[model samples]
Target: MVENSNLLAEQRRALILDEVRRRGGVRVNELTRRLNVSDMTVRRDLDALARQGVVEKVHGGAVPVMEASTHEPGFEAKSGLELTAKEDIAREAARLVAPGSAIALSGGTTTFALAQHLVGVEGLTVVTNSVRVADVFENAARGGSAASPAATVVLTGGVRTPSDALVGPIADRAIRSLHFDLLFLGCHGLSVEAGLSTPNLAEAETNRTFVASARRVVAVADHTKWGTVGLSTFARLSEVDTLVTDSGLPAEAREELAEHLRSVLVAGAEGPATSG
Candidate 1:
């Protein structure tokens, strides 16, 4: 009976994640009513979900971890910059995702765009440390247009940053312990010499751990970040499996980094500019 009950509990936990992803969030009372369980039982399930870093426990209910953040760029601030370029890059990134693959996406505006394009892909398991990214997946799943997002979406827990990125001890430990098939990461700054950079030290460290844990690393950065500098350095240029950027990259600098990375995919223009 004990083993059987444990199995049932696991099934219910899966249901809860599905529901949260479907509705973008659920209140504790709502879960009790909807799942047809006692409040105590619901609390236990929510606790388990919280432990796994998927849904966030709030005053009334649990919301997707991506929407757990207390801050984000306003609509205008984010929409005003690089709209077309971001979309083209997002389309390119989406094409790289294979169904039923385990992927990790880091926090950044560009990654958020990539998440939007993933709505139609089937059987993908996505792990992310960004509250915004999680919400994007949750919304996509809820649109109910496809097979209800066969993807298992997991969020990493930690302190929130200005960019709404989850960082610190919890995130680092969670990322380091898991191995991912592909990691789609973005940065606040990028340079051949400085490698991956972020203004926040904690976020930089968090990105580094994701880099170490993934079998392949794909950096999705816009050209604006090319010469930008940040507070700390995360990974070396050679560590990245692919660098996805816009055509705004400087010819000289792009040539320099091309010698190191496995491949560089430059989108947002007419064609890919490759180096020998």
Candidate 2:
């Protein structure tokens, strides 16, 4: 009877996942009614799927994971998904920046979070393809923040992606003409095989140019991004100087990443731990 009950639960969760994929997103109440299960049970099922990284649990429901190679979610859609993890990563990545240095930031929620931390850093010059990231500094300056005067922000001009990233020939030329002390890149996916990837092909090209222009590269991503490959790959794992991720990543996975990456910083309550 126990085995039978477990089998039923598995089947039910599978159905829920299918429903989420079909609809793009589904509320808990709707899932409960469709599956004929109690709200508690549906919530538990959503939690399980979220743990597997196959779906993302939202306010009262879940949405399909953007695991498809070509899948791309807009900036706002991604902003609320990994708030804590992104903040942790941003804090750690910020430590790598120095005053009076030119750095490049790529588009993605994680990089956007990092931009906030950098607002107070004195004498910093930032070049980015992300309109959202550029806005962080621009807004700070307008707000009369004393530290804003120490920062210079440059927004690349080009076609924009769903993530509010400027990409294409214009962005590419601008990046190639300049040099950066470091680059903080955010990706849709990361893995030993695919490395850093994005759903947009033009963004991939622009990211490649960013990598080439920088003396060092730091990839900032939460654990959920692991094993998720996007349509286009920008840089190999070997190309990154450091990887900063949240503690939600499994131990085994961190071990594997440390083998390819020069350094892996796992951010947690205690602080970021380094492995390489």
Candidate 3:
């Protein structure tokens, strides 16, 4: 009986997830009627999904995790998204780094792309909360770049989330003690009102520490992220020294962002040479 019940529960949850994905979000009452289950059962199913980072439970129902900034996609799921824009943004972000600069990178596909570009840069002291980003540099250092100045990679110890970001008191404490010349920040969403935001609450808190630790904060995001508000705000537009995004950003929105940031760098699809 126990095994059969468990199988039924799993089946129900799958249906709920499918419904949520199809409709973007679903109300609890609607789910109860469709599933022919009590409100409590529906809530229980939603709670389970929430724990897996599959769906974010709101007041009445649940929404697809990817639709809101409060729920983040896994690292692999996000990697394939916005590839062209991320590569262009990464190329431009690389131009801002000088040799031997101490830099901090917050986790996101955009920042990871930046990491790939920076592997060839000599003499970098990198501090990060991303395991993948550190691994990228670590692999590059093995039997590679013999003549290039050795880059120091610092990986923080903390609880890893679905986004593969290390966060918690451990990461926060480490960031407080060190300072960096620049911070290459990435986010789930960006808005003039929300500033730089992320869906995961812990990531938001850790990113705040990253903001405080860096002299210059450069945010790298794609155009699709504009105006999308996440659950937590890490830094305001005023806190960022520069905003780097692709030219896919609307002109009017660019004008609005220019009002808040020190500088806005638009990387064209043509690549770094064309972007100023």
lDDT (CA) for every model shown? Answer: 0.76, 0.86, 0.83
Q: What's each prediction's TM-score?
A: 0.70, 0.80, 0.74
- Native-vs-model 3 lDDT? 0.83
* RMSD (Å) per prediction: 20.2, 7.5, 11.8
Alpha-carbon deviation at 89 in model 2, angstroms: 0.5
Candidate 1: lDDT over CA atoms?
0.76
Question: Ten-residue segment with the worst summed lDDT in candidate 3?
Answer: 1-10
- What digit string (tens of lDDT, one per residue) describes model 2 on residues 98-133? 989999999999999999999888899999999999
Give model 3's TM-score versus the native structure: 0.74
Q: What pairs collide in candidate 1?
A: 66-131
Q: With candidate 1 superimposed using the best TM-score fit, by how many Å does residue 45's alpha carbon deviate from the native?
A: 55
Cα deviation at 196, candidate 1, in Å, is 0.9
lDDT of 3 by residue, 138-191 (tens): 888884866875589999989998989999999999999999999999998788
lDDT comparing candidate 2 with the true structure: 0.86
Kindly report which residue stretches of model 2 are placed more than 4 angstroms away from their true locations once superposed.
1-45, 48-53, 56-67, 145-148
Show model 3 residue runs off by greater than 4 Å: 1-66, 270-276
Two-way lDDT contest, 1 vs 3, winner: 3
Give the range of the ten consecutive residues with the poorest summed lDDT in model 1.
1-10
- The local lDDT score (0 to 100) that residue 149 gets in candidate 1 is 51
